[model samples]
Target: MIFSHEFSETSEYSAGTYTTPTDYFRYTLKVFEPGRSVAEPIMTIEEDYAFLMDSQWIAQLPEVREESVSAAPNELIVYFCDMFPFQRSVRDDSTRLLRDEIHNYIHNDLGPGMLEAFRIQSSDWGFIWYGDWTSSRPGADSERLSVALTKNGTWYHGRAPARGHSWISISVEGGVNAYYENLTDGLISAFYHELFHNLQRNMSLELGGNANIDGKEDAWQFFTEGMAVFASSIGMTHVQFSQTTKARAYLAEANKFVAGGGLLDGELNNSYKAMF
Candidate 1:
């Protein structure tokens, strides 16, 4: 079963334990207004995310969930704002119609730009959910977050200041269940982007440098994006993924130039360049 917990402007932590890992998974709602709660959804997006914490998905995504504070701490805050489709007609003032309008605008207008916006918001979820208490920022990043308690561990997520650089993740703003469809292959991009950013925290890399392949931190971003875009059904066959070796893949190039490396990091790296 699913247990839902809601947090408010004055609310902080709950008072007890939850259910099992599979039993208790948490998700954050993107409220456009100032004061909103899950009970009062307002918006219908859950940020682009999902996790099993089963340990077997490691190779494909290779990462484990670590436990944080015992109670809710705005841990994994997810911030989302519905967009109005640029050239579509709202027809009326219904939420369903509004959501459709927003989706259309994303596809035709924002185009690739939406990728940057979504990534910025998504990484916040990763940081808040996994980062320690002392790692939180107050008024600076004023987005609200929520968490659900489970028997195994609490499901944490939320949003932070939306003004940061889009270094950690690839954000796709307009659609729900994006993974199941094909559009420049955005779904696959989101999937790999999620783990690459989340797992990068554990690896040593130059992530937020200038170029996409800077070093430690930046490497995974390159590795994943390159592979994802290349593998994307969008059919970016123009750039080769296998023959690309070049070794210039994000994680690989970064560690060699600076200092970094870890499990799955390398495969994610050189393997992509191997395509060129």
Candidate 2:
């Protein structure tokens, strides 16, 4: 069962003026097993907005807008920009596919282990803020981006829940394609990588009050990003990486590394060299 609530409000941000007030819908999902008295409920909050540009480059462009949709009990909200090439429905389907893979991994493999290690609630609700638009900084191309905002810790732009909550954001502007023939393998990997950032933040909060690593920020980034890449690799395999052209390209690189005896050498490798 699903219960949804819509809310509309006007708010000002440093970026620009909201031509059309920001609005969002909160969906509460309840799942009950047959012949069981207990139910599992998850909440998904979605926010959509349109802004009048203040930047000179896109100032002439019409108001940019975006929306979000939930895949019912999936515990995630997939945000998509209207200006993007892919239609809303297409983006939704791809997001649902990714969400299903993530859900399975989290519940079946990572959930219990994480709960025990972090001592935090094992809820799976999260957000996937996507698109090409610049919602964080003005005049910058924020195409391929991923970030995690810890509640009450720091505000990195965009809407987030109140204190004590955390969320993830992903931008697919650089790699997203309108053609169904071009699969979203890169976007899928990026989504999983960003999702891992959310998981890292949650674990950090359980160990430390804030998500920041204090003096070890750089080292923390190194570890987190490497792990995120590793997680994405695993996720791609689960989603049948061979089916996507982009994934095949990634696998080719991996195979090259293995062929060079890198796998047995215990070498520290990362998805990106700069990550170290």
Candidate 3:
């Protein structure tokens, strides 16, 4: 069944707050807007998101359901929002396909290989923000976020800040087919990239490093983004994932901008470059 837990803004160890291999999972409405509860949704988006999550078929799939309880705390807890019309048919179909792809990737890649290589277990509990969180936010930026929760095979809607959580955010703001050949393919690539970020977080924590460079366009950004790019390159093919090429194109422009004496930090396009 789906479970809902409230965390105090000041308390770090509440009832539902969990400790994964990466860090503590604290629930919040938005990272920037702390203490905002789903009780007060931005629009009707939270309720719309709940309707979609309630009817999902993947949560019932025997194999996936089994994996849902896997020891790996790094497994993805994906949430979709701003789905244009927010209907059951569209949300169900999208969620079904998305879950299938995620299961395959984790079962084949992250669980057995990547996490194994790092001496960690399979499937860490982390949230992924898929689709647009804002309807009129303008531009496809701000889509890279990690949010939400689920329990006992039931999904619940919420946002967990990426800073201290093993969170992975993704977005296809314009349309499902806007970034890649299809939404599923684009999401897979994005998941791979973010999964690497989680690994980076865990490794850093193990090394006693608590530095976070998210949103900063500095040299350290390369270590995170570049490593993710490298991981995605070696882990999956981007034939159906067109955003890779798009990010590469932007990176080329970013290179020229820096070569022309533009500072890597504070510029906008560099954010896009850092995303992929």
Give the TM-scores of the predictions, in the order they appear: 0.26, 0.35, 0.38
Across 1-276, the per-residue lDDT of candidate 2 in tens digits comes to 555544345445466555433333222345556676564434334555444211110111111112233211122223333222222124455433342244343334323332221221122223222231222222322321223221222234454422111234433332232212332444445455554555555445555446553225364544455555566566556453556544432353354343434322212454334433
lDDT of each candidate versus the true structure: 0.31, 0.36, 0.37
Error of 3 at 220 (Å): 0.6
State candidate 1's TM-score. 0.26
Pitting candidate 2 against candidate 3, the one with the higher lDDT is 3
What value does the lDDT take at residue 202 in candidate 2?
41
Cand. 3 TM to true fold: 0.38
What candidate 2 gets wrong by more than 4 Å, as runs, is 1-75, 87-167, 176-183, 213-217, 238-276
Taking the tens digit of each residue's C-alpha lDDT, what string does model 3 give over 9-128? 444444654433222233344222356885565544122112242221112111211222332232222344321222112334553334435445434532333233222211222322
Ranking by TM-score: 3, 2, 1
Q: Write down the TM-score for model 2.
A: 0.35
Please write out the lDDT profile of model 1 over residues 40-111, one tens digit for every residue. 656755543344342100001112233444311232322223331211112322213243344444345333
Minimum summed lDDT over a 10-residue window in model 3 is located at 56-65
Pairs of colliding residues, candidate 2: none
- Which ranking of candidates, highest lDDT first? 3, 2, 1
Which residue segments of model 3 deviate by more than 4 Å? 1-71, 74-76, 81-166, 175-177, 211-219, 238-276
